[model samples]
Target: MNSFDSSIETYLSNLHFGHLATRSIASIADLYTFKGLVLIPVLWWMWFQHDERREWRREMVFATLFSGLAALVVGRLLTHWLPFRVRPVYNAELHLQFAGSDLNDALLSNWSSFPSDHAMLWMAVATGIFLVSRRIGVLAILYTALFICLPRAYLGFHYPTDLLVGAAVGIVIAYVMTRDAIRVRYATPALRWIERHPAPSGMLAFVLCLELVTQFDELRTLASSVVRNL
Candidate 1:
């Protein structure tokens, strides 16, 4: 597995396009991967589709968000609980040729890379979409693999296996979570509130999506500060 990972990374490292162009593309991909603004609009498009099962659509959207959170929590727990594995870029053994010159080495120095949270979260959301609309779901999954996961591997942030595990786990969790019983239990009440109180629900939903786009960075930062103070 290590050999397979190394060979793939080695090949990817060698294909690091020219200087500025590669960096720019990677930067954009990185931004979209976490911000997920690109995918969110697509999800919203799915939400408002003129289908009879609008409630089911909304329920699946809620399941997407809820399952994404589940995937993230599981990813983080595994990241911390399992033995640490350094990112490919930091693994001197791989001799990875970084595609870009700029990286916040310090920020991720302590972070493990055995399982990618981005892959887990994004794939979970994509899986949820797929559950709702098979055609769109296929597109969503493909977009995630190409537009999101590929860049991370090319940039040396993750091994292919890391992404595979993360995505597999996310897909499974989302499939189960989006099951009729599970989604109904969690999303029905929220859907009812949205139906009854459109104004408040709109505002709250916007805030929630904003936070998801930003990966809840502000909230996590505040939590970290409180933890440090304690």
Candidate 2:
């Protein structure tokens, strides 16, 4: 496993691209990846698009939302349950050089980087999107792997295997969640309830989206502060 992680780590670190260009990218990624400005909009478009299968797409939206939340919770639990591992950037042996201006390390000193929660959440959502529309789903997945997952590795927050494992788990969870039995049994009722209570539901949805877009940073920071006070 060390050899596998090191092989890709060595290559990415060796890319002598000017640190300036790399910093620009890291800054852009840090700013936008968590913002979800692009990705969430795309999902909304998918959900509202006029189609012969509008109901199916609506169901899929719920599946996407539920699966992503589940993956995020699972990732957090695993992070706590498993042994702590240092992020690649923090691992001295890697000798990784990165533009730190954009990387958020305020709460990462002790955060385990074993399986990337971003990979898990985005991939699970992407997988659910794929179920609704193959073409869009494929694009979403590609966007996720390239724009989202790749940067985690490049910026030294994670390793190749960390992403792979998270993605694999996310994919599996999404597939299972989207299965006919689960969707019919759960998503339908939720959708009906959402329809019946638009105001409160919309408010809750907005909060959930906000948290996801920010990668729960605000919540985590608040919790950390509260713990310190306690």
Task: Tell me each candidate's RMSD, in Å, in order.
Answer: 2.0, 2.0
Score residue 23 of candidate 1 by CA lDDT.
69
Q: In angstroms, how far off is 175's CA in candidate 2?
A: 0.8
TM-score of 2: 0.92
Local accuracy of candidate 1 as per-residue lDDT tens digits, 6-69: 7898898888678777866677656845337866776778777876888888889988988887
TM-score versus the correct structure, for each prediction: 0.91, 0.92
lDDT per residue (tens digit) for residues 1-230 in model 2: 38999888777766645767787667655775543665677667876788798877888888888888899999999999988988888887667675452465856768999898889988998888788779988988998898888877877788899999999999999999999988889889988998899999889988887777777888888998999999
> Please, what's the RMSD in Å of model 1?
2.0
Candidate 2 local lDDT, residue 125: 84
Name every residue pair that clashes in candidate 2.
none
Question: Over 4 Å off in model 1, which ranges?
Answer: 33-35, 225-230
Q: Using TM-score as the measure, which candidate wins?
A: 2
